[model samples]
Target: MLRRLFGDWRPTVLDVLLSLAVGTAGLVESFGRQGSQPGQIGDPVPMAAGAVVAGTMLLLRRRFPVTLLLALIAVGLAVRAVSGGGYYAAWHFYSTLILVHTVASSTEPRSRRGFAGLACVLAAYAFVQTFQHNDVAELMIGAVFVGVAYGSGILLRRQMDQTLRLAERATRLEVEREARARRAVAEERARIARELHDIVSHNVSVMTLHTGGVRMRLGDEHARERDMLLGVEQAGREAVEELRLMLGVLRGTGAPGSGALQPGLDQLDELVTHVREAGLDVRLRIAGEPRPLPPGLGLSAYRVIQEALTNVLKHAHATGADVVITYGRTGLDVEITDDGTGGGPDGPGSDGHGFDGHGSDGHGSDGHGLIGMRERAAMHGGELSAGSVPGGGYGVVARFPLEAPVGVR
Candidate 1:
């Protein structure tokens, strides 16, 4: 309640009206109680009239402060007239005090300064009248009124300046908060876009290429080729299922259900079989017993193997490859090496340094593909390294922490 009264526009307006009313009431009482005797007091009618006129002027002060000041001056003069030079002539100064307040609050600084000068002139005139009538007490009261009104105006001006500065600071803080929120939302959208391109584009392209190969081989009508076509069909179906699971993760549908099996370290045999059928001999070896891994690590492991084999087909042109998996107390390690000579002179089949800078499209994996692999490994608290093997072959080595592997196990 106090905040509403002191901090808002309505409260200021009410304050102005209340101060004017109090000043008017004081004037009225002073007028009506005048003694009307020589050097004793005078009639009350003049004071009452002055109070009414000043109060009426105050009603329009916010809109016309100059007019209100003029009206206050005229009322003070008329009150003195009815008093026959014996009334407490300074009573009207209370109304002048209120006029100063209204003018200071409502008018421009220059206009308010002009009103202050006018008030000083009026105070001097009242001082002359008091000296003429020999009323020392009324003269002192009038002088105090003039001093207080001027002081109050100065204080109110400082308060208004402070209020404006505080409001500007609040507006600036709000703008910065809104800008930060907008930037966070934009960054989230960009991340989603990158994920969609990485997941959907890579999966769909692989499916399309394998499908075309199956069609071409079916046209040949060989029994062994027919078996390869069947294998391709099975692989394509599994790819579709994997794509659906990834899409579910993106859409906030939660991880794939227990019924959906995603390839992990245990599925290395199947991965090698698929690559071999694709005309690359990939041998799989597991050095230690497999343990259940967190879903993200399993998925990352699957994708790394898939990308490595894809690179063998697209860049190696190798007839065979070796895949070695090792389980340790701290983590799992995977290494894929292919004896394909499809990359350039310094390709993955050259010296060990060849594939270091081949993450770009120069290798089978595009720049984004390697970035996706790195991100996946990091997600599982792991690391992945790719380079040429000791011989003329490409090698990819990955290690996922055993204690933790992306999200809750």
Candidate 2:
């Protein structure tokens, strides 16, 4: 109930009510004690009534600060005129101070000059009243009221300006935070794209090659189709597993203490076997004894090899390819090159390279293979290169530094 009646919005409501009630009672008391003496009624009715009106007007001071101030000044003048300076009619000085405070605190700096002019007029009137009555104490008291009210208004305005500045700063920070979140979301989507490309292309190319070989060996169409279907099924299942693993990481649902689904340098042997079984002659050579590598480095290495082998199967049509892993003291180096089958599917639409090597096919050179490989390598601050060897077929080479265990560098 108290808050409803006396909130920040209507600060002067209670003041207006109390002041008018008390002043009106005082006016009645003074009227009952009246006794005329020339221009003086031996009563305080006029003085009390002027106070009630002036205090009531305080309620509108904030809404119409200038107009209320003028009304307050008029009331002061009326009280002085009627009482001829008697019965503490000088208390209107308090109301004048209140008006000055409202003007100083509420009005903008440009309008404050007008308020200052009014304040000067009020000060002069107050000074003249005190001077005429020869009241030094009243004069000093009035001066202090003006000084304190004016000083407090200046300080209050400064506080308001500070609050506005802080609010603007908070707004700017919120905007920047939203922008960063959007950027993070976009980056995550791009990472997912690269992952899908790597998984789909590598698995599908393997399935295709195996299915083709099964057809040639077994002239029985049903048998060939069944084997091809099985290969497709297995590849798809593997792709799904990898995809689920990656999604688990993305969703922060990975096993406790586990991070991203990054199949690294150690998985090269299994990867090689999958291709060899798909009817390719794959020779694996490990130079400079194997060593542990960072998770991102290992994943990049694996993806580079996967893309290279997929390219060979699709474009070179080669029965053979070479997988060489050199583990240097500083970093890991991987090279995959395929001997092309004489004039097989070397033309465009065969591989992302498109034989003419100008990326002629609707499917450009940055095939799923190149794009995935590039993303993997760049993820680890590494570089990947791919192009046809000078004489015959295609080659993919990638190098990534393995400086630490597993974390962002």
Query: Candidate 1, residues 1-409: lDDT per residue as tens digits?
Result: 9665335434357556755775567565764456645654456655666666666655555555556567666666666766656444444555566666656655445675566655644654463455355477866766676667756775786788889999999999999757754554443333333344344545555776776576665655476776776677677667766765665555454422232344556676777787788788778888886777755577677777776776676566687888888877678887888886655434443433233223322223322444555666776779998876676777888888887434535
For each of the candidates, the C-alpha root-mean-square deviation to the true structure, in angstroms, is 17.6, 18.7
> Which has the greatest lDDT?
2
| Pairs of colliding residues, candidate 1 | 31-44, 36-41, 36-42
Single out the weakest 10-residue window by summed lDDT for candidate 2.
354-363
TM-score of 1: 0.47
lDDT of 1: 0.62
Report every candidate's CA lDDT.
0.62, 0.63
Candidate 2 yields a Cα-based lDDT of 0.63
In candidate 1, residue 338 scores what lDDT?
A: 85
Clashing pairs in 2: none
Best by TM-score: 2
